[model samples]
Target: MAISPQELSLHKLPPQNIDAEQAIIGGILIENDAIDKIVGILDQNGEDFYRDAHRKIYKAMLSLSNQNEPIDLVTLSSTLRSGGVLESVGGSSYLAALVESTPTAANIIYYANLVREKSLLRRLINSSTEVVTRCYAGGEKIENLLDDAEKIIFEVAQDKTKRSVYHIKDLIKHTFEAIEELSTREGHLTGVTTGFNRLDDLTSGLQPSDLIVIAGRPSMGKTALALNIAQNSAEAGFPVAIFSLEMSKEQLAQRLLASRAKVDLHRIRSGKLKNEDWPKLTTALGILYESPIFIDDTAAQSILEIKAKARRLTKQHNIKLIIVDYLQLVKGRHDADNREQEISDISRSLKAMAKEFNVPVIALAQLSRMPERRE
Candidate 1:
């Protein structure tokens, strides 16, 4: 009977111990096959050719040998094109030169890296056999085998040391510098400024990865305040992503345009848009669009989906700040008995995501219902 995921065995659990022998055997097979295929291609393609295409082919071969990525005609062509080699050459003549001149040891090294993806390696080897058979004749087998074995050992050792070293110190330092640079600018006009004018005077901008929570009762203009902050940040060349669960993108855009054009929000929402209002709305939208503000109006987005979308935005547009319309609208991953616990989890996750992405997260939250008093 098949075991369920929850009932899976812990005994002999670590795959490292169970698959050690199989891994070693697999590694040997991969290296041997790769060497044989590369040699065969070179043997079939006769020597004594010099061309730009040949140079591209050789460079691509060398890159694959070092990187241990699978080699195919398409990938090879793409790599050559990226390296400005394809533009220099007209055809596959340079590729022919590469197959003819690459050393047997280099071919073996390339195969040694293929141990992880045995099936894919096998397919690549089998597919290229025709080209291999044409270029290479059978060489001294034992000598090539020994060379491949040594190459695998050295490469594996180097990879282990490489994983142990961390080179992120410089990256962290540069990120600190960037945060400092941003902290010197004014953030949003109508938002809370930490209640200290001197500190706000020194550091005009809010630091990145900050979780600014705005709590207020109904009709407190919380959404308006948040939008103003987003607009200010976007206007300052800082990309902002707004997740509005309560409103549609068009509705939110309308509010921003009204704010920028100094028009009343109620007038725009009530569909009493005047003829003179057209120019202001259009001009405001044009300015906001060029300022790098992105809005997502998905109703009731889960925390996981929010995180995923935020990561994509950060990567694609280099988003510097994130704003969520209201915290209560967002649901957490778990189904909790109390609403408070769910809110807590959502808050924690949002804060964690801000730190992970190194961007500011401004979350708007609703206040609890006020107790009624006797008049």
Candidate 2:
């Protein structure tokens, strides 16, 4: 294969620090206690290592630790030997060299961090390479390509984030602080207010990560209730996102206007405004225009589409609540075996979205008439 000098120069060494990798392993080999710190920093495994040999050695150490066995020269060598990769890893002599090369286990955290940083850069490079390749593929949709590009970059970026682990001491302090703050408020709720006194009191004002289902029969104002809640939440200074699969945005706005102004819904819909209703309508319209309530009326939306939009809203607008007009109207996988199964998938997805965004989700549902029929 012929290659240009420029191409060869461009392919310069990928981000890596062999010394750091060896130091981490050596530190862990000398002091097994250090592995605990490195384990959490690395990918919880040996995948963070650039060299195959180092990866394999770290993996063997993890295996020994899992079995409650000590990680020493003898156990590690035996474990590698038993796995038939002892010779491939430069034999037992190379393992000894790693331990001798490292100064002490005290700097294991710093060494591990160095290796982790290099690993992230390498991943970013690989992701960029893939994105470039996909961009030239020519047979894919632009949206798909862009999505793939963003996804690869996002994965590399997201890898650097550590899982949150809140200590009980901190949690208890936070809880006490919250209780004290709440006590000082005359009627303020801990969670976002839904405007209705009884419901707000009963549910603690639509708690975060909750999937609140409002169910009823046909023409029972399920959507009307959701829009009202959205209005209330927006009025309370909380951003609201409503996905009305069954109605248009204009229809939702009309309903909200009528409800807020204490005017007749039918009269507004019929465009028959009485002389006195015009003042109330204009006032309601002005207030509604300023609320941080966003509505999406794209009907027959799949769960994935809804999630993508909701994620965008949460990021761009800091949306606090998500309302799906009705659960049964949501589109799910076409390969689903039955309608019941499809609805089940949508239900679970909505719940997951709520938890993922740490926001409340209100999905309107319809009740079955079998009980009313006395079957």
Candidate 3:
């Protein structure tokens, strides 16, 4: 197929560094030890390479490495030929040139970083362009488009670098060091403190990447409990994020202030306070205002919307805990035909978000009313 001039110009090659890719490959071929360093730097697969030949060559190298085979020019050429891709990858001559191009393996990490950086840039450009095209098409609601655009951009920007396989020796060393650190701190929490001494002691605090669900019937103070934890975490200098699907931001603030000041919620809502209550109210407001807590009271927030906002908060504020006012109120990215399925999808996404951000997520849920009848 032939390409038109306009299309050719518009689709000009994506950001890439072919020389760096070749240098990385050459370095690995020269010294097997360099493979570990290159993998650490790139932390990606052969698909990250820009050129088809380079992709095939890297794939072959990875295969040999995984199989505990040698990765010299001779071995690489034989593997490529056996796979029927030697000619497609420019034959053994290209492999020889790659080795000749790299003088040493010491700088292999730098070369690999260049390749990875170019790949990330290419992803950013592609993602942004797609978002722009969607905006122009006007097929979806503006709000939905905005949510999708933000989701795509967030995924591209916050995508964690791929992890390379680690040797058991390295892992054991890390574990030994961690155990030593824990030994020195007797009775100290290993994770974020939840402000309840008994609960903290039982679970060693709200662990990172954990999804904690607080379930109860109506009038059980689920919101109050979540707010209390958020306040406590924030006061301890840990950043907190709250998604209030059931209440507005103002209402949540009032509740927090009431809890902190030990005042009746009705008095605060009705704006009727005694002379001494003013000082308590002022103190509560000051404390909460100074704490590193953020609230997003977006009613009926979709899982995608929450994830995007949570990622931004994680990047900007380094939040340690995320609280969802209630789980039943959150919407899923795709509306399921059944309500139960929708809730399930939302719950799964929340769990994924917690793991991705490496933060503890506390979600409030309503329990079945069947228990009431059992009594």
TM-score of each: 0.47, 0.51, 0.51
lDDT of candidates 1 onward, in order: 0.57, 0.78, 0.76
lDDT, model 2:
0.78
In terms of TM-score, how similar is model 2 to the real structure?
A: 0.51
Backbone atom clashes (below 3 Å) for every candidate: 12, 0, 0
Query: Between which residue pairs do clashes occur in model 3?
Result: none
- For model 2, the superposed segments whose C-alpha errors exceed 4 Å read 1-187
Output the TM-score of candidate 1: 0.47
At residue 193, candidate 2 shows an lDDT of 85
Ranking 1 against 2 by TM-score, winner:
2
Stretches of candidate 3 off by over 4 Å are 1-187, 333-337, 373-375
lDDT of 1 by residue, 39-78 (tens): 2222112121122344345445435532345565556667
